[model samples]
Target: MAPRPNIIRIGMLVYPGCLRSGAVMPFDVFHIANTLSGLRVAANRVHFDTCWLSARKEKTLTVGGLSFHPQPADLEALDALMLPGIDHQGPYDLSPLLLGLGPEQEMLRRYAQTGKPIISSCSSTCLVAEAGLLDGRRATTSWWLAAYFRKRFPAVTLDAEQLVVEDGNHVSSGGVTSYLDLALWLVGRFGGDALRQSTAKVLAMDANRSSQAPYIAAAMIQDEGHAVIERARRWLNQRLDRTWNMAELAAHCHTSPRTLLRRFQDAAGMSPTQYAQQLRVERAKALLESTKLSLEDITGRCGYEDVSTFSKVFKRWARITPREYRARFGLRQ
Candidate 1:
């Protein structure tokens, strides 16, 4: 393939039922990137031109009960395309809605054949899955719909905890609000990383989110067999400083080790060890935010004997070094 030009042309899928903000945010972010790029030198500048596109030829389009003027799509002319979330009512079957988008699915299939990126988040991720774009691919969707998404699209590797997932050209972000994450990522991809950071600062957006773990409420994870997982989590939290033992965790949770592993993995999307590590990281974040503790002190408090290992794990979960996290979000003395 030839080199892509500095001017990125992106297309957004527009339809009546999609969320308004989902359609609007990428435009807003790219608009900001374009504005900020003007202040940069020629070599550092990157620009964007975007279009609101629909499968049908419509004079005026209604999206999420609001109005939009959209062009009939020309996928070949664009560098990439984005899909906005359809209004999905949760814990319910979506076959009817997915089947109804015949024209849109065909459009997506045609576009996929070109190997250009098709980015989506929230409920519209189901649309991409239904269209067969996500098969054998790792993707994510709104966490509430994760069970249904896994059942419906078993071929796709669904990691619901991550805020954004970039597998090849198809980037999937989590939830409706994560469009900001996706948009900033696109800015960095086409406009360069510095431009992305500058645009994020102007927009007052934290563009470095690595996971959706911080935002997922504990209550949301307590469904079905999750009570056992919760019990195991509590046990792990209390014993963070001690070496982890699956047998002991299972005994305390009143289940066999096999059952505990299966249930915890099913409920939490991670193994018990991973969960233990995450719990330790969360505790470390609190200490970092509230106290002027040294890294060594925080490391021991969060179950790691060494600051180096603690720092590595903290960065993996938080997407920044503990010191950086503290510098940005820590309370001043």
Candidate 2:
């Protein structure tokens, strides 16, 4: 076996509106890994000392209303820092989520200046993006927020399909539960593959679940009360099985295609056709999850006539084959 690394200090940032699970569950995983490492090695080969840190050295409340009193972190001595996700209720309502995070961002900036690895999960990647750490870096977030993230942070390339992406010292993960995956990945990176695999088995988690595509829903694309976008959404929903070109959609919305495109880019953060495809994918997902329809029939119902074309599109949006999606989420009699 390789020589074990020194005791590593991991600081988890806790604050208001952050997901309680994202903040707390990874600690459990780390504890498990630490316990296993202590048992397996002579004289405690690897050690992870984790502590919760607040931005202001005070108690922080989570979105689920849990209060946390944490030790104030010494940012300079930390080996790694973690920024878990915050809570946002409605679709596309991230403006408020990024509020009150300035101090935390400054701390994160200071930590990054130390040239150590910084990890963020789910919506907390927004905070990382806002701090300018993700500028020119490849990152990802919860799949549903890909378009909105792209709109807000244009410099960072957002890959919505990936469950976790690591670029240099910055590591990011997608969705809520993906924090576990991020934790396990960190374990593997620092604690070795054996510890990672063993902890995953003990936790009954499939470490191979590496794509958010399987979990993304079209409804996650919130309208944010944009009149034109909502109208366009309804129009697309009513005719998901029919192919209506952008011209027809523009005509129905009573605007030129150029105007419609501009409004869609402003309101929905994607083009009209992209939104239409999203709706179609959502419809197909419904069929896959709730019906016994064959792939060909479902494809035709979802506006794709060719099976090859439909499968490719479905996999791109859903991140799994239609058959696999059905097997996992389908209603079993």
Candidate 3:
């Protein structure tokens, strides 16, 4: 395509149930970028004009109960579009919001066909998935809803581990707060790497955050209502400090190893060995966050024989070292 125009027009789509921050944070970032661009020479400046658009012209209430009125705009004329996540407690809470967007799917599909970028953050990726644009494409959403999203849209490849997934003209971000990263990334895409970095520094955002792993809670992986899985989970939780043996664990759960593997995978989306490892890592995280124990002590308590092995495993699961995880949880490094 032709070089991106000097003047970029972006439209933010807002509905009654949209998250207030998600709807306005991008505007703030672009506004900041525009303010910064004013200081540069003409050749180095990038201009962004953003409009908040909604299907209805009347006043709308945000999920947080704040009143908002979005201006009417032409989606076809804009160079790009953004879909902020909706605020909801669970998948069922989103049913009404998703149903409300059913009328706009055709328009959204035509817009996607034009190949103009459509950026979605968190739960709003569901909107694009509903329009079928994400079919056979890699995408992500809030980490807590990964299993639900996968079940809802089997055609899309859902990787909740990613902070952002850019496939063709579709860019998706994970979690609610990732809209900041998404906004900074857009700045890089439109302006340059230097502008992106400067904006991140001004905003105090962690520029190196690329994975959702660090933020995922251990409880999210646990599935309830399966007797075999629950038994295995209880068994593993009680023995996080011990070396895992699949046959022994299977026997303890009162099932054959093959049956145990199949049932565990069906329930937890991972094999028995992987589940035990994650459980141990999660225990390590808990200890790191709550205890004043040294790394060597924590390692031994969490099943690892040495500090080095524990640190490596912890980094693999949490995407940060044990020390970093401790620091993040409010302990001074």
Q: Lowest-scoring 10 consecutive residues by lDDT in candidate 2?
A: 56-65
Off by over 4 Å in 2: 1-5, 39-44, 59-65, 91-93, 258-271
Give the per-residue lDDT of model 2 (tens digit) for 44-93.
Answer: 45778898888775565445668787786788988888878988875356
lDDT of 2: 0.84
Which model scores highest in lDDT?
Answer: 2
TM-score of 3: 0.91
**Root-mean-square deviation of each candidate, in angstroms?**
5.2, 3.0, 3.2
Over 4 Å off, model 1: 1-6, 221-333
Of the two candidates 2 and 3, the one with more favorable lDDT, higher being better, is: 2
Error of 3 at 329 (Å): 3.0
Q: In model 3, which runs have C-alpha deviations exceeding 4 angstroms?
A: 1-5, 57-63, 222-227, 251-254
Instruction: Look at candidate 2 and tell me the lDDT of residue 173.
Output: 95
Better of 2 and 3 by TM-score: 3
Tens digit per residue, CA lDDT, model 3, 234-316: 88898988877889888988999999989977767789888777888888777877888998898888888888887888888
Indicate the TM-score of model 2.
0.87
Q: Against the true structure, what is each candidate's TM-score?
A: 0.71, 0.87, 0.91
Task: For model 1, give the RMSD to the true fold.
Answer: 5.2
- The superposed Cα distance between candidate 1 and the true structure at residue 290, in angstroms, equals 14
